[model samples]
Target: MNSSSPIASLTKHLWSMMYYFVRTYIWLSLIMGISITFLMAHLVFWYLDSEQLERFVSSASQTSQQLHSNLVTIFTHSNNTCSEQNLITMREDLWRAPLIKDVVHIQDGRIICSASWGNLEAGLVLPKPTIVWPERGLQHWRAVKDPIKGDIQVNMVSDGAVAVLIVPDNAYASIPSNYPNTGFILSTEDNRYVFHASGPMAPENVLTQSGSSWRLLLTQQCNTSSKALECVTAYNAAPGLFGKGLWFISVVGVLSLAISALLHSSILFVIHQKKSLKRALRRAIATQEISVLFQPKVCLTSGRTIGIETLARWHDKHFGHISPDIFVAIAEKNGLMPQLSRLVIEKALYQASSLLKTDSNLHLSINLSMSDMSDPSLLSFINDHCSGHRIPAHQLIFEITENSASGFEGIESSVARFTSCGYQISLDDFGTGYANLSWLSKIKATEIKVDRSFTQMIGDQDPYNRNTLSAIFQLLKDLNISTVFEGIETQEQAEYILRHIPHATGQGWLFAKAMPIQEVARFINTPNSSIQHNADAAR
Candidate 1:
């Protein structure tokens, strides 16, 4: 069967579809894995943070109790009066304590003494000053506004006396505020009386002390829940869950990528082995079990077949139809490129012999390799074959791939000799490599085939140059060098090339993909091949 057989194309299309499906699944799995990892990380961090806050509240509770014990010892030992020498000593002792503001004593519901103010003179009425506070425990906490300094005092009272602690705002130094956007709200468990209230909107999450009357709230330092959770988990989370989640995710991703790559490689290996590419290639060449196909290159202005590019095809027993590139690669690796090239050239010349005789203007294009060119007897071999087939050298244009044309040192001289002997040389796949302008200046071929990349850009505005191929064609015209646009797969691509370079030739699926040699006459029978400007220029 020919390389252009419908079955071969259908197989490639099916493989492409399957590849897309598998690629999409792989991407989805990758993304899902990452998301799950991060979510789990945040959850872990939040739990740790919550636990840390509970411990902080517990510390606050212990501190409150210690203050309670100190107040109890001081009140009962001084005969409950300001004049006691011990009472004066107690006041002196606590006066400079950081947590204490003042200590006051009451006798029979009358204001009797204040530690800092001494005895009340002229019988200042006490009137049982209001003490409404949260009932966290048997002890009482009262908040009273200070008039002059405009600060508040929180009083911790026992059965006998009241101990005034410094204002919460001034005393917050005892609690840590090290975390970002996160602070603690120091208040009673019920929140009825706030010792140091975390400002409004401070705590978005809360935790209570396990064995105490205090509540600790995590404030709004964290904007998102993830950040908040991370902050909480990081509170006392020194040397904690910081890098554990990332490490787990990295291992998962690396293992997945490795496994996926291995799986794909194994599948491709199976495909390659089942087809037995090396063996099939040898069999195909030995028995000439291959078909020759030709894709017509039409003149843009005339819409007539000016030339046809030769292609070879082989149908495998197991893999159905394989791509030409695969077999060609196998041939090169096995050191059979010379034999393969010679066989294809001979077949193309023989199969198209009658067509060449019928149309004097038509030429056939055949790709040549570096090995074929480097062979000293290659020119003679081709001439002998052409002479036997009665085909003129001018009618067969040898196509040299850009890469093959560049590396060979004496290639330019050899190619020049071929042209001098009535044969034409073409630089295939032009503008797709480093050899475009550099090799063009050095080697100088009769024709340049603009590679598919440039053809694909036809009728499209150049992202960089803007003028793009339009400018290129104008330069070609000035240089009087013929141009052939390759890989014009759509009618729009065809129209774009024709409209811009009407004198040039084009070969692509639009005009005619490669077809069996037998189908050549059928296409050529109609001189006007119904090519029109109907297709929009490709953008």
Candidate 2:
């Protein structure tokens, strides 16, 4: 190339400057513009697809739940087998139901009185229940080649006792045909009570999610392939989930904005929520606004406080007693949990140390989140607090929710160190949220806190629930893991648990609601004062 003249050199420099500007600013702008456009397009696409998926899952789940409920109710209400007249009436009533093809009451694995069978068949084998919850009733049961209808039918065993309500295969056959591509698979495999009844595609084609009674399955092709996409998108089935897919877009629109306003306006009316919350939380930490509440864990037989679960309570001046659930969730989501948890530990340790000084038998329980365990310095941090406060580690129980058990999968060895160091591990909310033997076996758990749902279902007449609950408690007992029945609000419940487990630990309103540090100290001071008098159930 030839050497440039002075003017040519100036022109080249200007061109280079333009290129630099384009590279640094213009190109970046172009990339951002493209990214935003793609994002908007993706959001639109997602909104459409999600609408159909939501419809399929929602309708299928609702239909399944209604059918199961009807089955259970009919069988449970029927006392000592249905009479011939009652059987005819039941079949007639069931046929009127939206998806009821047939109904039946089986005795000893044989169908005796079926909705379609007037005289009743001799022997009709029913498929086992597709899903069975631990203490909840059996559901989504299927029977193949019915002795009466000739078509395949599904059954729901009302605790498999006085009845087995049979539903026709066609009950779940077509998804209205009005709503297309969107279909589902309901199953009870692996303890999941799912419901699947034809249409859409093979069971393997769809993805699944488990809820109370059924698992909602949806395929990736729901959006594009279905001709009834519009109808499906327009339809709403699940409770409180109408047009939920269009929420973000609807935020700027009519119907949803008002509803959104109604929902958010009530909760968000607190002034300067986001920034104020962060500041309030941070200030609360600095000022030690976190007060510890001790809920007594009493022995079922002895009715004495054996352990106290340490709960952190924050009542912000501006917010005025924000729920622990809300505040804690906020702290975790915002990455303030570690600091909040640390503050909680320090306060608990200081107080627990004082308590230990007086009574050596008392154990202080502290709840731990996954993040708290993930801290590389957590063990050391805990050790420092224990050593610095002169409190024995055994007196402190680190309660982890069952949901968090799997989250600490790789850290089991790390957690084993905590347990080995005399810290007791108790799985909290035992029956809630996918708490199974698999996760139970993974952690070094010493105690299981059975959730309130099972405790609430305890009654003299509820044989199905009673037997199921007994079996669950017995299984835990066989595992050699101590049990603590949580949310015991009545003497009846407390007595029932003790009758079964005898020495099992009991927590919740029945003993004492979580009390302030001062109240707890007073309660500990006067152990024989009768917890009933000391407990203010209003809390």
Candidate 3:
């Protein structure tokens, strides 16, 4: 078997794991998103319907109140001592008033005054009382005790009469233009019609009385002219609006799910390709497919290289130069991150062990992801590798990004394990992703790598960016945790950090680009390399 057989198997396993995870995640997300959207639409429609009903009821009630108020005003203004002839004229005037259907002056429970409708003879007296008069022609009526004028006087010889006004039911039927389907009724408490207006009422009469007044009731049907047309249109359209709404939601849901499936398929395809690429890369690592690069971490004050951060580089025989970011992201997606991390640790440890024999003070920093922190076997792997190589744990620093500290289930335990084993912990990309000051004490990280955002803006004349960096550096200093400013590509940035945040250490292209392991070794070994000379001068 080839030396890389084990890595090939691991890569295949990683590809399988990634495919399942992506598929599951896509399915779950699409289902949830579509379901929520449909539910929200349903809730919106229900809310609109409820608001329409409430508005319709409110408008009807307002009209009724207005009619009551108008009648009370008219009755209060009338002279209670008016003679029969004068009462007849008063009734005629009131009957002509807008919304008053008919006005009848009742004197001693007799219909003495009425509006002339085809020689009906205004002020005609009726035998006995017209208290139980036929309601066949009446549209609507309302009887209200005039609060200001009090009740009308009644004699034992003659029952007191009420001034009955007959108004077209059209007044109450006048719904707001927006709600044409709404129906209304305005009648006395005893169901007497104040105005019987909706369409022609049936031949049935419901009579009831309030106090000494007789009231007649009639029923009218109401339908929205527009809604009736809309209903017909909707029915002819096969599926109605409600059904169409549901169908639209279903289509959206199906499309979303289809897209999710496609996405999942694409992810699987990429993951599978990555698995092959990783297999080839791992074989290269085992047979030297990957090359280690080192960037010296020089002491800001001393200017001597105190540590080197290990960076992985790859150049595939089939595919030319691959970026660490591309491969690293693929590795993470394909579940090969743990294996990759182990490989890096092994390579770094072996190199550090060799370097330590010559320079006992030299330190090696290796980057770790949140996945590595939760890996139960990671601590053991590190301990075993170091012990096998006879390297002290104190010489190694495990660097983790700020994101790893957020909701990291076993992070505290992992940190404790590594720290107890004499491995230094550094929080990398400190200003990014949940970089809480409180976590510094909790994780007991020995170092913090200030994110590129703050470092890039270090020399900016913008007060906002400058002040923010100043605050962050000061905060780190107060915490007693050393900070390394990342992405320093300019002389201005270096000067700014040195002057404003003198306590910080940094590494970037300004110092040295990550180079091949051989180049790194040669640079370190060079007696008077600019990096070494600068380090010595700074110290």
Candidate 4:
């Protein structure tokens, strides 16, 4: 075979791969576009409905406020005159205000005026007003005292009549024909209806409160009163609105189904294409595609390489390059993070074991997820792997994120079990979650990783940031837990930590990016590694 024929075949294979991805992309784009459109339309409708409801309620509340203000004005003016005639005039004025359903006035234990009946029963005698006081009247009185308006219902008896200014029960029942299905009923503090109006399409008996001033109830019904022109307008609009909503929903549903079918086809195509990609990646990993990159942690006081944080890197044969951030998220989503994590742990242990043979004092730290912790078989897996590989459990540390440890239900038990197994537990990203020193102390973590936020701000001249770090460092120190500062990218950051928090440990790009096992091994064997040089430079 010609040598160039193989190269041409490789080129054709690459082109086929590209064509597959492009086709998949087109299908995914169409599906995603449809999905996004439907979602956005639904969101818009939801938002509009919410806003409309709020506006309707707000209008009702404003109407109630006006009525209350009018009543209060009438009471204030009449109380100043302190005359039965004045009260009678006030009642008459309120009755003619178009919205007021009824008005009854009580003065000095006598019903001076009654607007609902259009007459005052002058010769009638009434019982004591105290009988109508609701049980929670005292609480209402306290709430309404002074600057706050009183909304409580109290019994008032005068001239053989019980006069109560009630918020009417059906205020929302009589709204004008043109208005939407919206109306409200206003009640006094005692839950008695004072004013009520209704519209043709309003909801039935929906009650809302107004900052304790009034209780508003609302309801609506379809208007079927007239077969004439005016009633036809309302009848036509109701069906139109309902039909429009239904049509929109139906169209969206059909489109969504189509999009889903397209998406399913596209996903299958992508999966087929990715099979080759995955196989190449697997082969690379089998032949050392997985690399152990070390980030150095230095002793703040001595500026020595006290520990190394291990990060995993992957390279694919067909895909050429891939980011762990992307693949890791994909792996987790695909339920493969456990397997990926196990591989990393095995490789890390094997490497750490070899390094330990040369230098027993070195520490190797790796990150573990909450899912890993909750795995019933994890402990036994670790035990088996470590024992088989001749790796000491004490030499490896597992870092757990604070967000993962939020619900401490099974965490304590899990931590205890791991600690008993000679595995060190470090709380990663401290001070960013509900995890405090009390929680840390309870869990009895061997180490706490101060979030990169604090480390990044350590060298800031700003007093607030400096003071915050100082307080956090002091708190961690008092807890007798070792502190590891993450994301130290500069010599200034290292120096600031050394000067301010001499007891804390530091780790970041200031040391080195994570490397493969062999490369890390080579660095460890080097007489003067970059990690040591950086530490010495910092000193």
Candidate 5:
């Protein structure tokens, strides 16, 4: 009887725990299921809305580029500036360019003549523009009230020769009838000026307000061209999971509650299944998942793109974006550096072959690790690849880090061999690692890249840091070695480099970020845009 009683008590205890567990699980599942269903519905609507916005922005960008191209054509054909014949030509262009409402001749910050208003007696003095892009030689005004047409405002863009006028509302008048709550706004890259806006949301509200009810996607449009602007497309959230009936919601809620019991176990399984870095990297190399990007180097005095440095980039489905430093270190440790370097070189040269052929002066730079310099096969591989691509050896600059140069034995001879083969060598990241000055004297480098650590010290109040920078700059100048000031991210840094090293080139985000191959082509296409010329002229 005592043994039976103990068994009964143990069974009751187990039953109670199971009952509580089941009850809790059921409640949690019900709650999570409802939440998930609502989230899924919202995602569906958001996806649809984003697609619509993407199409709209793309169309607008094409239209803007077309208009700018036509305007450039008008400027090219009309040799005379603001003359009677030029005015006639402008009027004719206005008729041909459907997007352009009118054409105005601007000189010395004043409207001298126009297609609509033939000529002004003394020229109507104009106010300052809302935004200016010195690099592209472009300026724009968001709202200009017409003197003759009472209360009508027009948008204007000029290249210091002729201005093209556009009716702001006409640009965004194609909003679909179904998307009643959809809103659009076009602004400068810096968001300083609103070029156009439409729908229920005002430009001011769209820019200033941050609300979950409105989902906004901002895209930088026409950034690589003269016609540069940013587009913002908004969609107001639909109420209650896009109007799913109560019955549907209830059913989904019940099903989710039932399935919630297995969710924890499934998540655990997924977590354990994630691949290690080595395994993933090996797979990436095998699948050719690595990509190459280009960072432009601009002449400090002219702000013209002079060269581009190739950068290896990788994105794994599970790992997202991996930094080069991490991947490179892992590759070296795993005896995969050679393979990785070859992959990067192959892709970069292939992608840049056309651009290199077009511009002989535009050099393509590739970075090499210490191991790469040590490998005998590397030089031959690169030479063969260059020959295949028809790229000149002199057009390729091999960039080696300071550590790589100092750590590697017989690096000088390696560099000399490369130079003898007509390739230029650059000592990159000049100020970091071991602080050795012997490598500078030993290696015959064509160029030296001042590290960003030094660039960051431009505005330092400490006299010691300032003097160190001065000495470094003076040393490079004394060596007569071509120098590239890396990480110049601000106007101050650029100005400082310009003041100290007038002949030096710069590479950084202030001019442009590292972009894809296509953007590089577009950026190099316009040599006369003169970012620094306008700045100098303004001064």
Candidate 6:
């Protein structure tokens, strides 16, 4: 039967429609199931982030008040005049004050004595304070460059008669490195951001007044015997796609994907209960009843079909169409994945031979199971098929799901072996499994396919969701690895990905549906195919 004949075209069109319908339902189910998972995870993470901020601010406030009490005690007990004995007393007090670098005596707007330098040979004339607390007669000189200290900057706080010089760097020694975004500021009780030793948590202008660019996490007000000070902590609360909120986003994202996968598996489980799916799947693979379809992966920037992913479709005469998920799971559980994988790879390479010969740049991506990765003969099996089909190994991309790759103990070496033989390895369904960031280094994948769930988040304005996507994209970009986004169903999603990740490629209904080999060939050969037209339209 000629593929372009009316009957054949009608059959192909019907198949395409059925495939689209089934896939749409599956994706919708997956999305729906995962929505609750994400919502719950987001709530949990948000609570944690807020709790952490509150705890940190509370601790900072307590520490500030304690230090303030100690400073006041030192000032009240010391003599007002710059006496020889008084200088000795100040020097002794320095041994108990860890945060204070030095203490100096001030009289009539002049520095007369210091702890480091017992008595000044010539009194250093004091300049006007940067900030003044008239209520407590407190004066603060912030970030003052001192010639006596080799021109190093120091913060000076005084109560007319005595002063303390503090190192700005030492002020934040208690903050942990993990909280990189955490910032601290000292403000007066009147909500005025005082130029204190702790310095401004955000930009000077932003700290001076409330602005949308920053978010105040929490504030703690405490009395210091003389005056009241507020301990302010905040972060760059721009509500960006990714920032400090990535923790919440990633947690939600991972759980959502897990729920989606579980929902898909449960659905397939219920469908295959009436029949012996494992037996049917085994027989289908043996009789080669399963067929392969090619889905084009289009370059977001160039609007070109760069490659195709080979998908397996099984239509059992009695049971009707069986999803690849069901059949593939049956194959894996029944120790038939090796055979199924080999059959699919052999067919794909052979079928794509002519396309490969015509265009060297075009690659065929094939999914590999844990069984195949562990099989020592898998490499030779693929190489033999490629050799017979006249297709170069470089033109073949072996995609391994995160779950499969993580399950295999020696996946890194297995993947490396294939890559060494010129086959490209792509981490498929990334972020949908329990694999951590270290997994990428272990597998050394040439590319990563961003999960459809993540693709669904492209246009989401939620801070956590945006941050999660941002973190994922930035990590891939930083790794300098190739990325492909899957399940891009809308023009808005495509544009969002392209705008953020300019070099990425994507596959979804918006570009083209999975098609038969004949349609795949025509779609690839057609210069102005609908895929390119859609891509252009999207741009």
lDDT of each: 0.64, 0.64, 0.59, 0.58, 0.75, 0.74
Top TM-score prediction, candidate number: 1
Worst 10 residues of 2 by lDDT: 225-234
Measure candidate 3: CA RMSD: 13.5
TM-score of each: 0.55, 0.49, 0.48, 0.47, 0.48, 0.49
Tens-digit per-residue lDDT, 1-539, candidate 4: 79999999999999999999777777776768577757766566444544554555555554455444454444444432324675576666666454544445544544455554434456233343332334422111111111111254232211222233433333322323343433333334333322233444332233332221112222222112111000011111122123246677788767776776677677777778666655555555456566666666667665555677878887665565678766666655556667777778877777667776666677789887767776768778888988997777787788875444455677788788888989898988888875566557656888889889988886688999878878987776677668898887877787666665567787777765666656666554445344344445556
* Deviation (Å) of 29 in candidate 5: 36
lDDT of 3 by residue, 135-159 (tens): 3221222233221122432111111
Residue runs of model 5 more than 4 Å from their true location after superposition: 1-275, 402-407, 434-436, 527-530, 533-539
How much lDDT does candidate 2 score?
A: 0.64
User: Per-residue lDDT for 104-160 in model 5, tens only?
Assistant: 777777777888888877887776888787887888787787633536888877876
Query: How does candidate 4 fare on TM-score?
Result: 0.47
Residue by residue across 1-539, what tens digits does model 2's lDDT show? 35658779889999999788546654444445455544554456456655666666666655565665565456645554658777766765675565665566667866677666654556666556554544554444555444465655444544554444455455654445454334455544331232444544444433233221112323321222111111111121221223235653344344433444454444445434866887888899889998888888887665567888988888887779978887787787788888888999988888767777677888898998766776768778899989998898889888875344456565577568788889988777877785656657777688888888898888746889878788877887787778888898876776666666766888887668998666877776565433343232211
Model 4 spans with C-alpha error above 4 angstroms: 1-289, 402-407, 433-439, 461-467, 521-539
| RMSD in Å for model 5 | 27.1
Worst 10 residues of 5 by lDDT: 232-241
> In what order do the candidates fall by lDDT, top score first?
5, 6, 2, 1, 3, 4
lDDT of prediction 5: 0.75
Badly placed stretches (over 4 Å) of model 3 are 1-288, 402-407, 525-539
- Ten-residue region with minimum lDDT total, candidate 4: 227-236
Pairs that collide, model 5: 29-257
